[model samples]
Structures are given as structure tokens and as C-alpha cells.
Target chain A: MRGKYLLGILVILGALGYMVFGGLGRNLVYFLTPSEYLQDQARYQNRSVRLGGLVKPGTVQYDKDRLELRFVLTDGVAEVPVLHKGTPPGMFKEGQGVVVEGRFQEGVFQGTNLLVKHSEAYQAPKEGWTPEEVRKLIEEAQ
Target chain B: MLKTQTPSRPDALTWVFLGLGLLLLPLGLYLALAAPPDVNQGYLVRIMYLHVPTAWVGYLAFFVTFLYSLLYLFRQDPRHDRVALASAEIGLVFMGLALVTGMLWARPTWGVYWTWEPRLTTTAILFAVYLGYFLLRGAIEDPELRRKAAAAVGVLGFLNVPISYMSVKWWRSLHQTQSIDLTTGRIHMDPAMLQALLFNLLVFTLLYLGFTRFRAMVAALEEAKEEA
Candidate 1:
């Protein structure tokens, strides 16, 4: 009985200690905005971290090959330039929310991957209406 | 009918284990912090000292659970069931530590806290599966059924552990593969940093043994109360 009891206590304490002081404890996750990235430029110079926010309007520039792409990520206060050497997601566009993954290098946010936030709202076509009928009904309603 | 003699508690062994743990703390601290940074990755490499060991111990804890869970099912002893439950709980805690540390390490190394890559996704799934193990235990009222059901799930859930570890090599992903290769016996690290990691691993393993023993004791007491 005593043997079992000792085992139980050991397991619990071990788990707690591993979480609190272990290497895992030191590297807990935190998010950074574009403004914070800019404000702490010197501090974050070469460190890798996630930068999340909306894509700045009119900042997206895509090469004809669709492989090399450029855009600006913004948190409303500041904008950071993003360069990706991959195909952008179909849903990726200007003014959309996006998160880029890569290190900050030479004043650019080089993204190896891009994740585009999809809109949730859904609009239904009018009941019993064809494409032409829908146009005619909109004109009649106006 | 003759009564069997009760096994004596190994007080000396317990003291020895505790002493070893105390000695390990200073050595682990030195290796984790006092050691110089790597010439390549710099200080961020230090995270490996903690993350890797936590991951190793998490697997060890779960393996204990799997073994004890089988014992409970086959022997139908409540003592075995208690030990299995205690191990599972400890395993969950270590798994959480591994995930948290992995995220922290990722922030500086991989540049993101979360990703849908194979290893990350599978690890998240492993965490959720164990979490579901606890929830399943809570949902059941019958002690015998709870033990059997949880044991089955425990065995099945462990199947993902290897998958999580190997996903990086199996598929292309942004997540970095393992740092150490046992067959090659070559560590891509400075000698001092390697020493630190090895020291920390020993300390964490000792710490793990001590904690597991303590938790098992508490579980035994709880079982005795239930039986009484």
C-alpha cells in the first residue's frame, strides 16, 4: 500500500514541475501586432514570430508567374511589408485578414506561407428567381 | 488458509531517489542556463534542453499508463486501476508541458505559435485524445466499466504518439525534425551545450520518477477510501 502511495505522489509532482520550470515553461506563446513589431524593431530584428492582421489596401502585387508575391500587413497603426515566394491562396486579397509566417529580415516580413481568413456571411438568392429574373426583380423593386 | 506477509515499504530506496533528485536540480540548472549558447542557433537552442526532455518523459508517463492499464484489465485489481489512472493524469500534464514548450520554441524558431502541419496537428490531436480520456472517465458512474473503457482508450490513443513523432519525416512540413539521431550518435551542438542537455535530461528523468511515485501514493489512498 505504501509503495503505491509513493508512486502516486511522485507522478503528480513530476508533472507539475515539468510544466512550471521545464523548457516548455520558458517558451510560452504570445502574439505580436504589426505596430508592436515596428515599435520593437531593434529587439525583434532577426527573431521569428507570427505577425497577424489585415492586408493593407492596394499593397498586393503579384508577379505574372504567380510565384513571387508582395503585400503589406497592417494593424491599422502601422504596416509591414510581406514577400512570399509561393502561390497565394485563392481567397487571399487586399483588405483581407491574413497571418504570415517567417522571420523579419532586411526591413521585410518574408512569408513562407500565407493563411487567408474566410468570410462567414452567406447571401441567398431570391426564392423562385432565375439569374435574369433576379436582375429584373431588382430593377422592378428599385 | 495461510495469510501472506505484507511487503515492507522501501524507506531507504525512497530516500535514495529523493536525494538523487535534489542533487540533479543544480546540475540541470547549470546545463540549462550556465552553458554557452550554440554557435549556430544561439540561445534559442536552449529551449531544446527543456522541451525534448519533457517530451521524453511525457512518453514515459503514458507508457506506464498503458502497462498498468493492461494489468488492471487482466488482473481485475482495483490497485492496478488506480495506478493506471494516476499515470494517465501525469501523462496529460507532461503532454501539456510539451505542447506549451513546443509553441514557445516555435515562436522564436519557426516564427509561429500554431500551424496545421502534420506534427503540430497530430500532437494537438494526441493532447485532445487524452483530454477526452479524462472526460470519458467523468461521464461513467460504474467503477468497473470506467476502468475497462478508459483502458481501451488509453491503449488506442497511444498509437498516435509514434505518429506524432515521425510525421515530420513522413510528410513535408515547416516543423523541424528531431535534433538528435541515435544511430549516428552525432549531436549538431557544441560540447558544452550537449553536456547541458544531457544533464538536464537526467535531472528531469529523476524528477519524473520521484513525481510518479508520489502521485501513485495519493492514488492508492484515494482507492482505499473508495473501498472502505
Candidate 2:
């Protein structure tokens, strides 16, 4: 009876171990910054990657008819072009940080999905601030 | 004056804990459904009040089982075994609730009730592992062997909790990433939503504590009967 119980325990644990480690190993893609993926370009090429960065200002171009969005994602130090085949989400805009999951192609991140990488505290864009106004405020504070 | 209270009867507080929980259920539902819709998620977000707490409290209950199981192993006490079983039962109940609520939430948001998405799949696996613990416990008739086998499972099954939580980060999943940051220990929801979620969390937690206490007392009575 003791031996039988031990065997039963082993069978269940074995099956579970396979599911946890094995399933995770096969499906997981190393989440990376644009700079990290750029650093090891060859190794990460043609592989699924979750690239996170800010949406660079003025690089956002959307075609409403085609439901296509093209933008440059920048991490201050590095930038990658992203092309996504979907209507821009309501909160999606320049200067917001986002994570794009896709494969690298011909120097572009062909994004399959765009997710705000963190809590979307910026529900509505602030109304007053602009480039020049922000610059003047910062200069005065300085 | 010498007549004493009956040993079979539990104190008033136990009943009070249970009554409060039962009474609060409707209020919890009202608060959950009546809260303002989220900016992005809309009405679908109301599920968070129930789903999030169920998952969190389920993990906490399993953690209790793990603690008692470890103690049982070291101390060789039947009391610890009883506590572990009681905790697992409640944990299973909440886990089932989380799964159902999760499915209901997922269908409208993700376009499917079930997905191979890492977090959803991992949560399913967690449910299976704990259910296996109960099955193992039933299979063994010898109380000594039963406690030992069940304890072993209670310890091993806990390894799934962290994996279930981290799957959203470790792999590609449609599920939203964690809103409550554990490292910095800050919640990332709007203050109103946070309040509703926390309120329900507190009510559910007290309910869980009270329910488990009553369950453990019943187990003690059963053990006493076997000895008698």
C-alpha cells in the first residue's frame, strides 16, 4: 500500500512537471527592449519577440481606411519601426509606451499585437501641455 | 450554576462570521456590478472584483495548506493534517469560482471562453493539481498513509501558484498583465475601482477565515469520535 501510494504521487507529479516546465519552455519568448533585440540582431532574427518602447513622437502614421498603423518605437537609446495591421486603439498615440509582439522582418517589427506594457494611467490625454509650453515651464523651473 | 456549556456547540462568533459572509454576498454583487465601467474595458471590467479576489484568496488558501502540510510532516500531528485538508477544500472552492468568473470575463474580452494563452492554461493546470490532491487523499484508507500522501501533494501542488501568476509575463498571453505591482507594492487601478476590489477582497477574506475555522472544528470533532 505504501509503495502504491508513492507510485501514485510520482505519476501525478511527473505529469504536472511536464506541463509546467515543458509547456513554458516551448511557448515563452524572452521579453526584450528595442536595444536588447538590436544588440543581438542575428540571434533574435525571425523569432517571436515582445519589444517594448515608447511610441516616438511624429513618426505615427495611420491609414484609417486600411486599418494599418506604422510607427517608430524608441527606448531613448534605440528605435525600431513597427507595422501593425489593426486600427489604432483609442489610447494609442505618440509618446505613450507600448509593447509590440511580432517577428523582426527586413529591419521592421511586424507587430501582431500592441499592448500598453503597464497600467494605463493616462486614460485621457492632458489638454493643456504642448512642446513649447512644456519647454518654457521646464526652463522656468530650472 | 455548575451546569457547563455543551462541548458540541460552537461559540456565537463562528455563527456570526458565517452569517455576515452570507449577508454580504448580495452587497458584494451590487458593488461589483454598480461601479463605474472602466475607461477601456467597460462593463467587462466589473468581473475583476470577484475574479481577482478569488484568484488571490485562492492562492492564499493554498499557501495556508502548504504551511500546515510542512508542519504536519515535521510534527507528525493529525491536527495539522486536518487543517491542511480544510484549507485545501476552501482553496478548491475559490479556485473553481475564479475559473468560472475568468471564463465569463474572457469570452467578451478575448472572443473565447477558453484559450491556450499562458495564464489561462496555467490556471487550469493549477486546478487539476489540487483536485489530484483530493483524489489521492480519498484513495488511501489507512489514516497514516492518507495523511502522508495528501501532505506530499499539498506541498508539491503549491509550486504551481507562482507559475500561474507569472505566466502572463513569461510568455505571450492575451490576458492583461498584473495591475498590482508586487515589487514596488503599488496598485495600478483607478482609486474607485481599487476601493471596490479591496472592499470585496476584505469581505471575502473574512468569509474564508470564518468558514475555515468552522470546518477545522468539525474535523476535530470527527477525530474525537474516532478516538472514542
Candidate 3:
């Protein structure tokens, strides 16, 4: 009886293992870089996709009255223009890693959601440096 | 038929662990508050103190369940099965804590409370697998058959823990990579923050030990009652 039960469980588990690791593996690419998206524009055009890249410096244009934000996202090799119609996240800043979820319309990416990807490193601000200075230092490092 | 054994009470060591953990929890919280704010996230980064240790406890508890499940299979011991169940119960709670705390942290930083990222997906799956373990345990009417099947689930389900831990690295994930990388033994955290995190981890570990022992004792009593 025990052997029979074990065999039954092993069969069930084997099927579950295939579904989880095999079927889900293909869709595991969480986000695509600008380079990756541009390489296959036809495949992603009109379809909702997340584009991960750095916000290009000097390209962040935010109109507080209109709640419209525009920026150029770059992967150092390629760049994509993004237009978002909402207040940017507090962490959103120039030269920082970000993932924008939206569909491509014309030549620009229409962003529906914006997410900041923080680095793994967690350091205390340098002694006597203000928060604004610390922010600038981090952006400069990018 | 053989007589059933009486349920045993927690011994002195169990009390020591529980007392120590309860005593040290405040110290851990103090250390976390005293830890310096991050260069970028400012005081918002203090959430790591609760999030990391709870997640660590979840991983450690599941690993314990995996080990005890293997032991139960080899020795056909009911005691081992009880321990596995106890550990898994504690693991599920801690894993839920990790998930909740992570979402709270993600909102201000990532701009959303949740996403379909790899790390989050795999962790959700891991949590489901353990829930299934308990369901499997409850469904079986035959004691031996139930033990064997639940043992199988406990052994197989733990595969998700490592997958979840490594998901950030194996795939392009929005979730940040490990601050303290286990595979490379490298830490990317400030010394003060690291100390506070480590202290919390210790406190949680002690609590886990005590909780599991106490829970297993209760399981034994319940089993004794059922048998009698």
C-alpha cells in the first residue's frame, strides 16, 4: 500500500514539475532592455510589454500642471523615447534604472506604469552630506 | 494492539529558546532603528530589518521540513513526520510575513505593491506548494499512507525555495539581487545595517526553534488523543 501511494505521488509531482519549470521558463524574461525591444520592434508593437533601461540624463521633462512626463530610456547601446501621463514615482530620477510597462504607438513608447529598479548596494550617506547631495552623487555614479 | 504513548511536554531547552528569543526581540528592533538610513532610499530602507530575517526564517524552516521529511521516509518514524509538519506550519507564516513586508517596501520604491516578476512569481508558487502539503496531509484517511504521501510532497515541494532565492539572478528581475549573496559570500550592505540585520536574523532563528519544538509537542498530543 505504501509503495503504491509513493508511486502515485511521484507521478503527480513529476507532472507538476514539468508545468512549473518547463512551461513557465519561456515567459521568464521579466523585462526587456531598449536594445532587445528595438531589435524586434514588430514582435512587440501594439502589444503591452515592459522595457527596462536607464533614464537618459537631461531628457526628463515633467509638466506638473499637466501631469505629463517624457524621458528617453537608454541601455547604453540603444535608446527609446517614453511618454507617461501621470506623476512619476518618488524614486524616479534621471540616470537611474527603470522599467516602463506600455505599448508602442508610432515611434514613442506610451507608458502605463513606471517602476524604479534599485541597486543591491545599501550605503549610508557620506558624512555631512545632505540628502539632495546624496541623490546627486548616486545619479552621477550611473 | 499496542498501547499509545503519552504526549510529552516541552523540556528545559525549549523554554530557554523561547525566553531568549522573546528577550532579544526588542534589542533587534532597537538595532534596526539605530541603523543609519540608506544613501538613496533614506529611512525607507529600514524595512529590510524585518523583511530579510522573516524571509530567511521561511527558507530555514522549509529546509528543516525537507530534512525531517527525508528522515521520516527512511526511518518510518511518526515523530519525524510531526516535526516536518510543525516546521512547515511555521515556515508558511514566516513566508507570508516576507511577502507582506516586501509588498509594503515595494510600493514607494518600485511604484507598485506587486508585479509579475520572477522572484515574486516563484515565491508565490513556493507558498502554494506548502499549502498543498497541508492539504495532502489532511486528505488521507490512512495514517501510514498519509505520512508517506505528505512526506513525498514535503521532499519535492522544497525545490521551489532555491528557485525563488536564485530567481533574481537567473532571470532579468525588477527585484533587487541579494544584499548578502549566499553563493559568493559577498555582502553589499553598510556595516551598521548588516549588524542590525544579522541580529534580527538571530532572533528570528531562535523563535523558529522554539515555535517548532512547541508545535511538534502539540502535534504529538493530538496524535496520542486520536490513537487513544
Displacement of residue A30 (Cα, Å) in model 1 is: 23
Better of 1 and 2 by lDDT: 2
Query: Which residue pairs in candidate 2 have backbone atoms (N, alpha carbon, C) closer than 3 angstroms, thus clashing?
Result: none
Model 1 lDDT at residue B61: 74
Q: After superposition, how far is residue B9 of candidate 2 from its true place, in Å?
A: 8.5
Candidate 1 stretches with Cα past 4 Å from truth are A1-142, B1-15, B182-186
TM-score of 3: 0.91
Could you give candidate 2's per-residue lDDT for residues B89-179 as a string of tens digits?
8999999999999888766544356644578778878888887897788677788888998899899889989988887777756676777
Question: By the TM-score metric, which is better: model 2 or model 3?
Answer: 3
Tens-digit lDDT track for model 2 on A1-142?
6567567767777876776687645545435778888899888777887787789999999888998899999999999999999876544667866778789878778998776532423121134445355444434432
Q: Each candidate's iRMS in angstroms?
A: 20.8, 8.7, 4.8
Tell me how much of the true interface, by contacts, candidate 2 captures: 0.12
Q: Write the per-residue lDDT of candidate 3 for residues B1-228, one digit (tens) a residue.
A: 676565588878888889999999999999998887897787789899999999999999999999999999999989999999999999999999999999999998999998878898888778878877876776687899988998898999899999999999999999999999999999999998999999999999999999999999999999888887
Question: What would the DockQ be for model 1?
Answer: 0.02
* Best-performing candidate as measured by lDDT: 3
TM-score of each: 0.60, 0.70, 0.91
**Candidate 3: which pairs clash?**
none
Separate DockQ for every predicted complex:
0.02, 0.11, 0.41
